[model samples]
Target chain A: MTARSLDWESGQGERKWRRRSLWALLLLVPLALAGQAYDSVKTLLGGEDLFPRQVAWGQSAHFGGSDWKLTDLRGAFGMSSLPPDSVPVLADFSVKVGDPDLQKLWLGCKVMLIDAEGRRWSPTSAVSLKAPGDVHTCVSAIFSGARRGDTLNLRETFLVPRQATKTIRPAVGLASERPHFLFFQLEKD
Target chain B: MMRKMANVILLLLATALCYGLQVSKPHYAELIGPIPAYGKLGDAVVGRGFEARAAKVAFSRNLKVDRYGQTKVFTTGGIWAVVTVEFAASAQSTTVAVASWRGPTGLAYDQTERLSFADGLLPVAIDPGLPKKARLIFEVRPDEVSNATLLISEKLMSALDSQAEISLGPVAAGADGLPAETVDTLDLTQPI
Candidate 1:
């Protein structure tokens, strides 16, 4: 039990703690860098969850400033304009867009078609053709200039290649915004 | 200390190499170039050129007739070149509109205002297994009347995705080179 020996042991203990702290700090640098890289890849590949909110088919959901309900969805391969290969999917929905505080609301929202295999397709066009029935009749209402209590009937059609196991849902949002979606799961017919 | 310095330099070099490799990869646009979907009048241009066909094209200096039978007179100094097309939206449901028009001088013009005469197809919705006929109108300087080219597309917002261009032959001009007040039907159904 000499003073010099006691001082040496204490010094050794101090050095060990210092080395452990340095290693811990160095480990954090790589972890932080790996997290950043993962985020970059997700963003680049559009791996971000576009439709965080999902609604059942024929169910109603509200986002931004409007109530939306997708009533019907149909898919057929026998479109004369789509060649013999492509299939056309139609989605019918009702929207009542109006908030007293909001001056002008645009209901001309865009839609994305997500198939069973998780493939996405933007509609080739949104149309209002006159046909017999509630679904076929053209509704001449613009969602962008909606006033209080304005209800619009609309449908969007998307064309994709025909597949045996085709199932789909409609992802709705403003025409040019992202990370905001009101998804609808519609029955595949 | 010297070995530590050398190791740091090697890491820097490796980072630089990875960055160089990432940047050198070809971009999507550069690798694929532009998508081509060219077609003449009367031919069925399907998706990207699919089942949709452009038929019975008629060009007029003045918009005397429209889809709704509304006749309009242009007050602006420029004359109107109206293109009436029979666009058949064949099998699949889709959107159709007059994307733009290119003058003989290579200047481009979009559909003119929907004054008295309806401008182009009004972004109409054509159903599956059906045909739709629509008109597209453009206002251009009187001198740009002759040899104007009209481009029709499923949706202007996605023009690059699907489109067809037709060559509108010369329009009859008056003494001052302004367009004459007459309708001329040209066969642009054949590719130029």
Candidate 2:
């Protein structure tokens, strides 16, 4: 074949390869965007309640050595009997110290109150309450340690507004440790 | 020659755009953003150069300290949250520092040196898999008592992978379904 003809053939092959590459790139851009769009939609649909599984009141969750049972949860204005005009929610849990390991373990745990707006509320203080047939009264207790087979009644209050009460969840975690939490869902019943 | 140059420029622009998107997206993200979770004892958290396990822990207003072989009484306006952490270093040794507390208000409180005399975990270096336990103390505010998280980062602004933000559980409610209220001031004279 003539040298001129061979040069023309090589140019044509190069153009064909370039065209295929351009088409491949054009196809890839949309594919990537579709994947991203799928992720964005998924996030938009159910991104709010990701980690702490929503649970109802009176639901028992087992973690480590003890079974933490959340018995009751109520909303009020302030942390105590003194009234507030705004929003505050209180949660009560019974931590029954079981086994020898539980007695020695540090029982100082914290409760996080998450509102509909995704605001987390921690207890201002922990106290023991004396309930005389439905009338609740708060009494101060030395919250240091727990003994085995001992049922310790713990209380925590959150300052959350009334409008944000639609979806409230209480997440429990050990006071000194990091991000592993015992999540509870609030039952509408 | 002009067409080749134009194609090269387009390829470069495409590569730059991809890189921009890749860098902008986070590695780990919660749909609502990354909120810290509560962790229990014996929970081993593995970070970049170290694996840490929280051992013994205590929260008190008055810390009983033995200084210069003498028992001294040190008190705080707030509460003292102490944790005994066992840190095991990987091949790449780095300083493990107890940095800050992520309060319930979604605020970060840094370590205060007021109780520097107290014995706690200081930023120290670790060797490969050689575990070293130390006492780390944090002075927390009264309002922050309910929910706080301990942020363990090697460097101040380290990447998320190199840091471990632990969820120290919140306070439990009483049987009456309300947080038991105690007098603001803890009885410091009482033996801890």
Candidate 3:
């Protein structure tokens, strides 16, 4: 009687294994397709909302700052033999919301100017991602122009997000998607 | 027993379906254009002199010369390469000369102009041959040779692979060797 019970248990275990294998195989195809569909949809509709806020930017004395600040205007460039005052300046960027799933929003811009005498100057800093909810960016640069003159130096920075941070109500079992606009301009101001 | 088995299968299938769908967003480069002509530059300017002038960045993977403003290479009506710089004065006299860039191209298509502490900005328009707005070396000329400060910017090649630096001449007294006149220079090239 004990031997018969052992044989019965072995058969039951094998049957369980077979059933589990069948289930796994049957669901794999559908699961894979679902994932692909989700990614495609998110690509079409913004997946998230991200806001640019003031964050601490660790900068050196070469840059205009004490130790830390909420600006990130380190324009990327080669400095192998950069003569002094060789800060390559990039202007403001027009950042619009693309598509994505996000939780917050971040935006900023770099502004620059050149006065009359050819004396380079980087004044009027912009607010950073940390502008007390509204963002206050500051732009600074290490200056050394002719003893004194007229021209002022200028450069600006701008950042955008892959997705909009603002949320929308769901509809037709569809995801909510929208585009945002950021006005980038330069004037006497 | 059969009914229980079917129910278990459906539950597993449902779980799989729910876990399958998710999305991501795309980011685009800022299309900020028309970088206007600034009256002054970033900070105190380096005095005028052809610090260095070698050859154009001969080759690269994806070289870029930014034209902070200005439309296309030659679209801005009478656009030109604008340069600015600051330099030390010699109680003694001196003369500064800029170097010239030599490339496969013929007569380097660039021009030069100098402004003073009282002149404010020295704007010199480039010919239609030059790019509207970009920065870099122009025709074998050292960055600058002037009686004051100078900045030279140029734009070359639209190809991805193109980069290098130009070694310029020294900042010394002219033939006279008198304290010498302060000079500055700048380059205007294509947005390529």
Candidate 4:
């Protein structure tokens, strides 16, 4: 009888130990999944521009190692070369270089026109507007070799709907500062 | 004793079932391969991002390209297979960047990089409501010309994305076993 009683106690202990192990394994499953998905989650977040650092027109904001200010957002509605019902909107920017490595910092630079509805239009070359001699495009300005404290004029032409010009804002994104870009508020809006 | 024997048999059967499942499962690459949108040569094979229609196919031994008033001749040891394709974006502005020529024996020949300087080639950008024509050139063996397939996609690593596979029907072989309609030289300077 004593042996049987001891066997019952040991069986109960063994069952409790198995139950505890199962609960520990259940907890580890989620931890292992999170560990494996850490890099992917980081990459997904880093690749997307989710945060916008807002800067009002004529106000400078420090981004991508430079101070960027939107100087002008003009739309040419009656351009004969552009498609019907579309206008060529030029976004002009004045950037003060704080770092000499513009080429590396501004690599994969993109300037876009975004409307209130979140409709984004990239820069287009379909419009044949001869920019001013001193004005360089966002991509071309990278190779200009501007020194620190030098001011550079940059422009980007986008073909957008004429209706979108009223609410559109110019935004700048650089490769280094992706996921967090400069979104300038238009004075007209 | 009978219950022990039955349990052993059931366990053996379960193990065999698990082994069968492991052996017959699809490979990881096959599971993540490009989703194919098949069509005939003339039919428009529409993918998720773009639509492609192969208009014509030409075979030539030499290709003449003009760049800035300078003419450069490209000669191939095999044959130059030029496919004229029209592409249009479905929703947004996208670039159709990759094309390949799959032979009858499942060998894939990528669009020739020799014609990289030529305008209106692969990696051409298309906007919505506007269609663009481009050329996909490949140098392939003579036997691989018949029953060929043309594959087009946005980029090279298009896993789980749509890929257009247009079938080119059988071709007639010449007396010399080359494609019968092959031209001696193709002048790419002329507009398609």
Interface RMSD of 3: 16.8
Tens digits of per-residue lDDT, candidate 2, A62-180, equal 65466677777787544454222335567777766564354233344446666555555555322233443422211221233445676667676654446556676777665222235
Candidate 3 chain B weakest lDDT stretch, 10 residues: B124-133
Better of 2 and 4 by DockQ: 4
Poorly placed runs, candidate 2 (over 4 Å): A1-189, B1-39, B66-71, B173-192
Model 4: per-residue Cα lDDT over B25-92, one tens digit each: 99999899999999988999999989999999999999999977899999998999999999977755
Give the B-chain TM-score of model 4: 0.97
- Give the backbone clash total of model 2: 34
Regions of candidate 4 where Cα sits further than 4 Å from its true position: A1-28, A51-62, A74-89, A97-108, A114-134, A139-150, A157-169, A185-188, B1-15, B60-62, B71-78, B90-94, B127-130, B171-185
Cα DockQ of the candidate 3 complex: 0.01
TM-score of each: 0.42, 0.38, 0.19, 0.75
State candidate 2's TM-score: 0.38
Ranking by TM-score: 4, 1, 2, 3
- Which digits, one per residue and each the tens of the lDDT, describe model 2 over residues B1-192? 999999999999999999999888766643333233335556887775677777754666566666666766657776666667778655433577656777789876677676565453457555432356666666776567566677776656453346666666676534543224422333222322
lDDT of 2 at B95: 70
Measured by C-alpha RMSD in angstroms, how accurate is candidate 2?
18.8
Per-model DockQ against the true two-chain complex = 0.05, 0.01, 0.01, 0.16
Worst 10 residues of 2 chain A by lDDT: A134-143
Q: Looking at model 2, give its docking quality level.
A: incorrect
RMSD of each: 11.2, 18.8, 23.4, 4.4
